[model samples]
Target: MKSSNLLGYAMALIGASFFSLKAVLVKLAYLPSEGANVVLAQNELEPITLLALRMGFSVPAYILIGFWAWRKLADKPSFLPVVQAFALGILGYYLCALLDFTGLLYITAQLERILLFTYPIFVVIIGTMFFGGKITRWSVLAILLAYAGIGVIFAGGEIATGANVMLGSVLIIFTAFLFAMFQLFAKGLINQMGSWVFTCTAMTGAAVSILLHFTISASMGEGVAASLDLPPRVIFIGAAIAFFSTIIPSFLVNIAIDKIGSQTTAVLAMIGPITTIIAAIILLGEPFGWVDALGTAITISGIALYTFFERRSQPIRAIPLKT
Candidate 1:
């Protein structure tokens, strides 16, 4: 690889590392404080409220960056592509994040993470379906290994678990799929519009979508009621998440992707789950049982194999007629 490409890969790795730490933060923030006398339940803030807080607070930070970039470049940002990119971000990253957070209330962070990390498998499946790529034997094997690891981790050391476990696991899987779709759409838009422009627009889309959803849900009695008593810790943690997970990683990954093409970028993304699992054990004090260890190793191994093996084949050329 060229020095520039190497630098881009390094940037992508750094972004992935930051993203990996996100699961740890989200789990910590949403996890309830102990004791029956605690005034607020961890899950008390409605899911929409959490989502709103996430996007609402982060939007301004991104806007400032976008404005700076625009002024520096001496260009009016293109509106249409940016909007489309925003829609993709809202649907892919934000919506999926909402689902992941909700599911976290019911599942172990490690298990939930394993399920969410299946996004790469979903990406491959969706790519094959829509883009007409063949799912080779290697791809099939990789998918099975990855999902089986998820199953082991999600079962929580008992292979025979109940319905709630299954439900949360399914939610994680769905989150992964949604994010895969997000990537497809976002990357398409990014190719046309630069990453900064694309991310700003997409984050705006996400912010507006979250706000509108909160408003409509509240109006319909489905929203998190406006609480006059906002806990300082909850607010601070929420802001931390928005800043670290979405705002910071968004720009970093954008820069990384600009440096490296999509394929290498996606491969580096595997780092998130690897880092998340370790962080879960150390930071969250989550147990790393035999099942968890084996499963994570198996999953990461499969991903590495797939990444190493999935080399692009050169297109066939037509033969020239004999003179």
Candidate 2:
């Protein structure tokens, strides 16, 4: 690979790694509600409330950053793409987050994450369907291998018996599809808009969606009342998550995807689940079993093989290969 392509791969991998770490962080941030001792357990955090708070704080920051980027533009910006970007952001990231977070209330983190990782497959399928692109044989093989690997990891674990778990699993899978749509929309819009402007608009859209949800939920008495009752460190942690998991990694991945391609990015995306499993073990003290380790290795190997063989069969050029 050329040095530039190598750099793009490295950036994409880093972004994916950060994205993986988010699973661990989200699990850590999620605290089981204990009526009396909730404060002491799991760092006194509430996932939904913290999520609302994080988006609330991020709005101004995104606006500021977006403005900074807008000022640097040489031509006048069009409003339509910005609006489209905002919609994608709200529908894709924010709504999916709502489903994922709510689903977390009913499911295990590992299961939630594995289901979310199904997005790469959806992305490939949707891109082919809507964009008139063809899916290669290797992509099919990778999907099978990845799903099998997930099964291997959870082989001995009891299937969640509750209806909530089943429902949550379905929501997580749907959320993955939503996220896939989000990426596809972002990719299309980003071609015409700067990454910063497009992202900021979409983030603003997500922020608005979260705020509206919080307001409606609060009116219905479903809102988190004590979200701000915690010490300031919790707020800091939330911001750190927004910045690291959302902002920085997104910036990195967008540029990298533009430099390379989403398929390349997706192949490297396996790094996310691997990092999440490891981070779960290290930070959350979640057990690391032989099954988990072996499954992760198999999944990564499958992804790599798919990407390698596919890339080898196709010709490389200065332009990116379409996803």
Candidate 3:
């Protein structure tokens, strides 16, 4: 590999690592004072409220990124793309994130990561359903293998011992599906509006949606007061999440895709689950079983195999960058 490709690989690894750490960080924030953290929140934050706070810290960065991304353009993109991006932002980030965080209330961080990582499989299924894309032999086998792995993890992992395991799994699976849809939505826009600009715009839209959601929740009842009653420690954890998981990894992964193309990037993304599992084990004391190990390995193998052969079957072409 060239030095540049090496750099891209490093960036991808770093991005994957940080993204994996998101589950750990969120778990920390979710934990009660007795479980961890030096300080307790004045009011325990609800999932939606916590999400709103996260978006609060994140939106300014998105605004700056949008301006920087479009600064050099002579003729800026039109209003329609902006509107589309905002809508997608609400759909993808706002909805999916809310579902994800709520699901985490019932699931372990490791399981959350595993389920979220299945978005690629959801992507293939969704594309086949909606876009009339054909399901390949490899895809069929990959799906079976992936589900088998999921079954093993579900049956054997300690996380699955929770009373609400089924509900949590279902919620995370739905979140994964939404994320897959998000990717599909971004496909066209990323090609036309540029990844940086579109991502920033979409995220800004998500911020707006979050603010609206919080406003409504606050008006409805007690959640808003609880949200505002968050302590400095909780606020710091939210800020860390915004910066580490949301902002930094987004750019790093996007840049990695730009540098090394999507195929390699897809394979590198497998690192995320492994990183998450380890982080959960060490940080959250989540149980890592033999079944978890074997299942995760099988899952990643299926994903890597699908990425390889799928890319092989597609026409060799460079992805176009907008602007």
The lDDT per prediction is 0.67, 0.68, 0.79
Quote model 3's TM-score.
Answer: 0.92
On lDDT, the candidate that comes out on top is 3
- RMSD (CA, Å), candidate 2 to true, equals 4.5
Residue 274 CA displacement from its true place in model 1, Å: 2.8
Output the better candidate (1/3) by TM-score: 3
Candidate 1 lDDT over residue span 245-305, tens digit each:
7777777777776777655776787777767778887878876778878788787777665
Task: Judging by lDDT, tell me the better candidate of 1 and 2.
Answer: 2
lDDT ranking from best candidate downward: 3, 2, 1
| Cα misplacement distance, residue 12 of candidate 2 (Å) | 3.7
Worst 10 residues of 2 by lDDT: 314-323
- Which pairs of residues collide in candidate 1? 86-202
What is the Cα-based lDDT of residue 120 in candidate 3? 73
